[model samples]
Target: MKVTQRAKWRYQQVRQARRQIRYKFKPFKHTRVTRRALAAMVQRVVDQSQRYTLRAHKTRQDEYKIVINGWPDAVQVTVGVHSLSFLVMQHADFCDFLLWPDCMPRRKHGQWRCFDTGCLASGPYHRLEDLLFNHLAEPFLEFLTKVPEQAQLMLYDMEGMHHACVEAVKPLKRLDRPEHPVVCWPLPAGSDIV
Candidate 1:
């Protein structure tokens, strides 16, 4: 029987993951804690985060950016108002998504006054998942697969939202640019759940 290199590599990866899970989780098993205590700890962690949602109607049509973390290299991609126009910067980054401009068009007389969809529909914005898969997926997977996961992947946008959780997925009306963009963060255990 012959084993291909890919199969051998996968087997090794599975073994490594099991070993890491056992070693890392051992501490939690030894420590005895009540349900109330566990709840308190979770609450504390939730309190540390500033929670908010990024709205699709609020995103800038003129600009779209995605920031990836856990990579050794600094990576950022931005798509401007023009079609097929984009900028990729290495190592230049921002933690707050609120700093970006609000490109959401205002409604005037029941009609949207801003050109939000046109710009976003153009350029490389549509290929977001693809771009990340090509350039950043390896490192991201490595980060996820590593032992004692310490790094977190976050998405930020112009709406001052951070640690967003997606509650729904829907399609856009026209241009099919994107739809139902929402962001949410974990709240305290007993607090209002998003």
Candidate 2:
């Protein structure tokens, strides 16, 4: 083959390889082994006193099955869960703890989008945990203030990701919703959340 032809062939191969790498793995697809592995990894990291329990979903294996249950405060709440994927591509990880409140609406099956600025928290794994905690702390605490002591909270993590965009807010007369206690921290216009 001519030198130019050989070079062209190599370039095509490289392009195909790049494309395959880009789309090869869909991490959100939940398999039995993947769920078990995730549960074990999370158990290893969480504190023993936390008594975090891993509950597997009988169905919806494609979504996150194991939920990390623990108390962030006096209120017994779910700290977070191990899920695959992220809203932004910058800080994508093999697994992430999508914290409560943020993880609340995310668990529902429907069209999901992030209108809040603090959707994607970027940093190292530990720092990412801190960010997740900070994002959820206020809302969860307020929820505890309203929730009756006898009531139980089940923390479940779902594995579905959607890109976030800016949004305009309307007037709010009521701020309390027993089912939804989410507090959104809006990003400044054209803010860099990478």
Candidate 3:
């Protein structure tokens, strides 16, 4: 018996279909971090701090707002199993401050796009904990304490602040700095932030 070209092509198609079905039903190995767990982590960090009075309140099913008393604005954080998003809201405008697991491409105007499942990294919980303490909380506290006035100014001038922040971060990307410490904001002529 001779196998014709048509038979070979049909065999390949069937094999491909089976592979697709297997992938569609494959059990996900990595467990997802719950919103409540993420919120509790934030609370622990806030409790340890002494500088600012920060309170984490659950505003939605998957979102929490960190309210800082005596501050001009509130920080909104959304947590996912694989990603975290930080935003600051002032009046009616908002700023996308940072995105964790920094693998996703940034959108135009310096905003970060959502995480892609294909870019998921191992030990997401550990990475997120580090980011929460070092990247999100530490820099945020510094921004409030070191330059309280500047932080307020940024909230007022959202567009200019965003542009400055985008420009400030461009050099860091090229330099590949491990820690992001700068909070770029508008300043008077001949004045600089050190």
Candidate 4:
């Protein structure tokens, strides 16, 4: 069998077209959480938490910033007319995570937004606290627990931040160990000698 150059070109073109069509029709794997949805999650966490206090203050003409203050850290959520920005602060450690909305067309230098699909999706989270606790608090705590090793090779790092990491991990030290059941069983009299 002989294949012409024109036939080979047509075959490649058909394959390229099929690839494009498949790419265009592919389903999105995850859903994005909008500003309002994130705000509601933060509000719910604040409400359910006994140790945290919520405060609201007007930031702009129509924008309001909600601040959640408590033990591990504090979260500042800026609710604007069309966008939302979140800033989670570990006051003692001076470490913070600022997350801007993904909907924004442009972002300033050094700005970051959430990139985790599971964290942004509402379907996986039955209660808002689960979303907030797992995504928000857990990440910061994990970072705090690793600061010392992460900064060990650095020539210079913030002393206070290291101090804060110690303070944060002190209470959580017990969690690093596995608990063993304490049980005592009396050996039978006829059992073999040890």
Per-model TM values vs. the true structure: 0.17, 0.27, 0.44, 0.32
Top model by TM-score, which number?
Answer: 3
Q: List the residue pairs that clash in candidate 2.
A: 30-62
Model 2 local distance difference test score: 0.34
Give lDDT tens digits, candidate 2, residues 1-194.
Answer: 99999999999999999887783223343456445544443343332212223333333433332332332221212333332321212234312222245521121132222234456633223322333333444443333234333223222112333222222452133523533222333222211121
Better of 2 and 4 by lDDT: 4
Query: Between the candidate structures 2 and 4, which one is better when assessed by TM-score?
Result: 4
Q: Could you tell me which 10 consecutive residues in candidate 2 have the lowest summed lDDT?
A: 185-194
Query: How far off is residue 38 in model 4, in Å?
Result: 1.8
Worst lDDT 10-window in candidate 1 = 49-58
lDDT of 3 by residue, 1-194 (tens): 35788899899999999887773222322324434445665676567545556677776665556665544444555543334455654434335463333222222233223244554332233334443444344545455444423342233243344412212222434323333323334422112333
Sort every candidate by lDDT, greatest first: 3, 4, 2, 1
- Index of the highest-lDDT prediction: 3
Give the better candidate number (1 or 3) by TM-score. 3
Q: After best superposition, candidate 2 residue 35: deviation in angstroms?
A: 17
Q: What are the per-model numbers of colliding residue pairs? A: 5, 1, 0, 0
Put down candidate 4 lDDT per residue, 128-180, tens digits, no spaces: 33444455544433432343321221111233322112221123343333341
